[model samples]
Target: MVYVKRALPPRKDNGQRGRVFIRRAPLNRKLRPKQLLSRFTVLWVNTAGVPFSTAGFTCRASSTGGTLLATANFDNFGTAIFNTIPTPTARTLVIRTFDADDNLFRTRTVRSGISAFAIIG
Candidate 1:
């Protein structure tokens, strides 16, 4: 599962506002037998198709599906932010799953092609 939360900008009357929360359901859609996931990786790329950063985590399967063995924060920008020039741009998210034996099982890529924007400042 993936979760993301961001603080909302301050309201005109209220100092700081609430937060925007997002969570992803378990990766069980169209799951196959013996296709247990052991590792998960997410890569963030710019509109130019240049990968800026990647985050990975280990998984442990259970009856419900799987749970991340380590704490993974999508907000951990690391070197990605410093390497990029901040501007109005779109990004792509690449999600990859691996099996227990370290074999990649599935891959999904989502592209936010610049049409969507939530302006805060």
Candidate 2:
């Protein structure tokens, strides 16, 4: 078995001999969306029920009150991790998906707590 390690970003007191440390960022309570459902995962898939992994495919979510919430790009597995999702101003979110050419693929007015906003083709 093998595990990988990554170099932590340099700190103010870096180079104190060879000792290093990583401090986790303090959790922001306000950033956590109030989920009406227990859905904490989003998976983008195609019409055939397969994960869609097309390049340049992306999703942008904004609050109905005109606040940008999250913009996530699809990964190789057609999964997007919203590392910094914040609570939306309204219960509904305006989520838009774009294609490889940067053209609008779909627009979905979904609940702020919806599991996924998918663009299947």
Clash counts for the predictions, in order: 0, 0
Q: Could you say which candidate leads in lDDT? A: 2
- Give the CA lDDT, 0 to 100, for residue 25 in model 1: 56
| Count of backbone collisions in candidate 2 | 0
TM-score of 2: 0.52
Positional deviation of residue 113's Cα in model 1 after best superposition, in angstroms: 7.7
List, residue by residue over 1-121, the lDDT tens digit for candidate 2: 8988989987685458787689765776345545653332346778888987756787777778878878888777777655565333336777777877889977777775455556565
Each model's Cα RMSD: 20.7, 10.8
lDDT of 1 by residue, 15-56 (tens): 445765688657877744452322333334456645433344
Top-TM-score structure, candidate number = 2
User: Once model 2 is optimally superposed onto the true structure by TM-score, how far is the C-alpha of residue 117 displaced, in angstroms?
Assistant: 4.4
